[model samples]
Target chain A: MKKKIICAVLIAAVILLSCCAILIQYFVGGKERIAYIYSDDKLVKTIDLNSVEQSYSFVITNSNGGSNTVEVRRGKIGVTQATCPDEICEKTGFIDSPLVPIVCLPNNLVIKISSSENENIIPDTVTR
Target chain B: MINKKIVSSIFGIILIIVLSSCNSQSVDNRAKESETDIFAMDTYMSLKAYGENSEKVLQKTSDKIKDLDEMLSVINEKSEIFKLNNANGEQIKISSDTALLINRSIEINKDTNGAFDITLYPITKEWGFTTGNYKVPTQARIDELLKYVGSENIILDNDNNLVSLNNHANIDLGGIAKGYAGRCAADIIKSEGITSAILNMGGNVQTIGAKPDGNNWKIGIQDPNDSSDIVGIVEVADKAVITSGGYERYFEDENGNIYRHIIDPKTGYPAETDIISVTVIGSDGMTCDALSTSLFVMGIEKSVEYIGTKHDYDVIIVSSDNKIYITSGIAEKFTVSSKFSEYTLNTI
Candidate 1:
């Protein structure tokens, strides 16, 4: 009887341990590593940080004559320069989460990140 | 007795393994999120659908929003609004979407007692808000344009899908079009079997359902003073959260006074109010969109009074005095962020 109770308790503890592991994985395992660049609200470029071997930079100019310079390094992306008055986008630095977006209101530019798992899920249109 | 205990123990072990595995596996499956970003309605629009058909649903929903953009854009020369604007007081045939938006605008105009009006295009144009010139219109110029700044002057015939202006009033649906598009996008996402989705037209957000994990979707309310800072977080499910603030679109004048894009129909100038921003949360995106603007114009005391008369919405008002007021309905779900910890939080 004592052996049976010990066995049951061991099984329960193992199950509980595995449950905690699963919870941790679900909450912290996936990180979005791809970034997208938008000019005037249009998706103009996409960068895959996981595959990036070296740092690179590019400039995007909107129809309204505003411009933003974007930089991408290993595992990170940011706006290095912009002609907008606020300079908020440049100060935002590098970001890698789908939740945080670097936006330049004067240039109508935005840089957003998405996980590789969500790369194909394109939203139809943005209304702002 | 030992045999019975062993049998039950094995059964319990099997059940534990099965149940825990199911929980983790189901969560993993539901975490599949499909998102798309497009430019429409003068802002970056993002749609995210979480479910089996997320990719296809997002594509279809994006197409729907783009179609609406093409049909409703005032600057798009071939759009219904463009044709109607250029009609010179003549009845112009419009698309069903354009007619519906006009009807909704008119309804909101009456509901807000003329606080929300789409007929302020002439005034806005003169102020260079649309042209990006950022000029202050003379008082004489504003008074002349104010004559055409009433939604009552526009007529919509739903049956024939026609629209007409009584006094050459040009309508600019910038105030409410984004919200209308968000509602339509949410509808498309739901109809496509996307049980969970978020439609963010700039800051105006509409959720189709709760997060797949059964937790409420947490939305951060942007601080009116700082673009990067969020003042609070709102937890909601299947609701629309729309924010209107003077800080969103504005220009600084020669002497350093700020002019917001939201022109007051009554004054023919940028809305002058102590309230910095107004956020409306409701099931209807369009109403929340219009109410955000209307409430911003109404200021704090009148907005609280206006909300008291309504049952379907809650509000978060941030005044220039640094006080944040949340309606009782949303007070429990709202959490003041550290950015606004210094500010007072009042429940109305």
Candidate 2:
């Protein structure tokens, strides 16, 4: 009876761990996190895949003397945010997907997203 | 025996359900990864439009645009109109590219009076806004350049194909040149098979086609008060959108007074108006860029009246209240979301 109980608990533990890992991979790995570029997280830029249209260009700057001009259309690329005024490195609009990063120049802020094919895999700690 | 079997089955089913749910989630996430192409440093102006073969095309196009910039710099140095070296009145021959831009400048100058003067270089230097060097100039110095800054003073002889500036005034196309380059790139891209692209030259933006899914290309207009908050999103399917804001370049005095770059030709001072930024969306990028600057200097009321006469283009103006004024047609196309809730979209 003791041996059976131990086996049951061990099996349940393995099942739970695997389930948690799968869950993390789905939620964290599949979709790129939308960057809420803000001065104080007040939702400065909503850079989610759903929100961005192909071939869109805009200038994003922060108060930190950083400014960047970003252009995204079909191909992904982010560049040219360094200007004399506010160099919000957000000028590099070149991220093709969520895996890449878009920066803000003046603010010295970096919002990173995933782009690699295996980006859907979640780590063990994060699965919880 | 029956009770033991029932308990075993129930536990097994529960475990399977939990396990399946997690497995499906992982599958769903991996399934949606979008495939995209990347164009790096090869992303010069005209090359962005060539689609798959854009890497090679971009290389060629960037070289061409850089060459154009160099040519214009040379023109700035030797043009008899600017006369950087000579104060004496002498007719100097210019390169064809410089002449073309000058001719275009002359037309805009003639049509808009001194409102769209390219010959404001001397005054621009006096204000110290051109090279990121900021300092308040004396009233006496501004007044001196103001006399020679009028676009009307520029003479364009179509017969001999020559151009001249009165009183040795200078011209600067920095405000309009990027837009022209964007338009040229758009034209080049359209010539190729690729139909969809966006030309984002600094604050000037132009769209070539709808999305790959054939939806309207949404371009967000930046809030003048807060660079992070979008004032509104403009739906530009096949058009150019350009914005000119008082916030782009400016400085604050000890008294906290703001001095901006967009100078009004009439007053020779930074345009002081309630409107914070002007975004013009039209068919041509260069036209949109020029008109946006012109309208910013013209102020809101007059600019709205001017826009009313044109049926094809649309505009959005952000005011001091953070209220957004847009054309009726544009209002119909955009969906007001939680982000723009604070902004009032007033249709002109």
Q: Encode model 2's per-residue lDDT on B50-107: one tens digit a residue.
A: 2565555545545555655654542345433345224444455655655666777666
Q: Estimate the overall C-alpha local distance difference test score of candidate 2.
A: 0.59
What are the per-residue Cα lDDT tens digits for candidate 2 across A30-79? 54534433332234565554345665767656565455555544334455
| Poorly placed runs, candidate 2 (over 4 Å) | A1-27, A30-128, B1-47, B74-89, B95-97, B110-113
User: Residue A18 CA error for candidate 2 (Å)?
Assistant: 11
Writing each residue's lDDT as its tens digit, candidate 1 over A1-128 gives 67767777776776777777767655555444778887876889988876789999989999899999998888778889988765557756676545457787779898877664432222221112
On the 0 to 100 scale, the lDDT of residue B171 in model 1 is: 91
Candidate 1: Cα lDDT at B235: 84
Restricted to chain B, the TM-score per model reads 0.91, 0.80
Which pairs clash (backbone N, Cα, C closer than 3 Å) in model 1? A121-B35, A122-B36, A123-B36, A124-B62, A126-B45, A127-B201
Report lDDT (CA) for all predictions: 0.80, 0.59
Worst 10 residues of 2 chain B by lDDT: B31-40
Best prediction by DockQ: 1
Q: Name the runs in model 1 displaced over 4 angstroms.
A: A1-58, A62-66, A69-100, A103-108, A113-128, B1-27
Cα misplacement distance, residue A14 of candidate 1 (Å): 17
Candidate 1 local Cα displacement, residue B177, angstroms:
1.2
